[model samples]
Target: MSAEKKPAPKVEPLRKTRPCPECGKPSQREHYPFCSNRCRELDLSRWLSGSYAIPVAGDEAMADGEDEN
Candidate 1:
């Protein structure tokens, strides 16, 4: 009897490649969104150091701790 070999199945990626936010370079699968470990760490450092912040509108009532009943 002769033995037959089967072809391997095709695989697809979960994410598409895009430019890295830190360096604008093509991102790698291992690093994801970032081109390298250095870029990733730099972004994290900025976040932890409060370099990035979310802006909020100045509401007088909230600032004075007054609740609207």
Candidate 2:
């Protein structure tokens, strides 16, 4: 009897990883920018608690509740 060998399956390489923004640890696929759920939640909490803010630029007089002519 002759033995037949099957072809090997293709192996997919893991995607590149970056350091977590919260803890500086290796990030995971599930958590993405964060390493774990805790880190992800912490980041979200910061956003929700107004720890992070975006700067805006406009007229200083208008911002000071003044009228312009």
Candidate 3:
């Protein structure tokens, strides 16, 4: 009986990141982690501006205020 040979495992190709997530510009060498300083700052601005808000249960003071109203 002839033995069947299994195919080699598939490998993913290496890709270079091109665009800045914040502004969609081609990445530059100065910004190793990010495409540019603007993108980095934009991310920070989003955090500082409450762009990623999370809901939480009201505390005693907040509950009291709501109850009064």
Candidate 4:
């Protein structure tokens, strides 16, 4: 009896190539949305340091506090 090995199946990417958020370079598979480790780290640092934040509207801010009236 002879044994044969099967070839691996080809995999497809879910999405098309996109620019890195940090430096506007083509994103890499290793670093995903970022092109390289440096870009990835820079984005991480921004997140960790509170540099990226969602702005709140005046109404939302007032709702969080008691009404002065």
| TM-score of each predicted structure versus truth | 0.68, 0.64, 0.42, 0.65
Kindly report which residue pairs in candidate 2 clash with one another: none
lDDT tens digits, residues 1-69, model 1?
Answer: 998988978775767889999999999888898999999999999999999998778887897999988
Candidate 2 lDDT for residue 2: 95
Q: How much lDDT does each candidate structure score?
A: 0.90, 0.90, 0.75, 0.88
The candidate that wins on TM-score is 1
Q: What ranges in model 3 sit over 4 Å off?
A: 1-15, 54-69
For all predictions, the C-alpha RMSD in Å is 5.3, 7.6, 7.8, 4.2
The residue pairs found clashing in candidate 3 are: none
Which candidate would rank higher by lDDT, 1 or 2? 1
lDDT of 3 by residue, 1-69 (tens): 999999989875545867777777777666744687878888889999999788777687776665555
Candidates 1 and 2, the one with greater TM-score = 1
Give each model's clash number.
0, 0, 0, 0
In terms of TM-score, how similar is model 4 to the real structure?
Answer: 0.65
- lDDT of predicted model 4: 0.88
Which residue pairs show collisions in model 1? none
Point out the worst 10-residue segment of candidate 1 by lDDT. Answer: 8-17
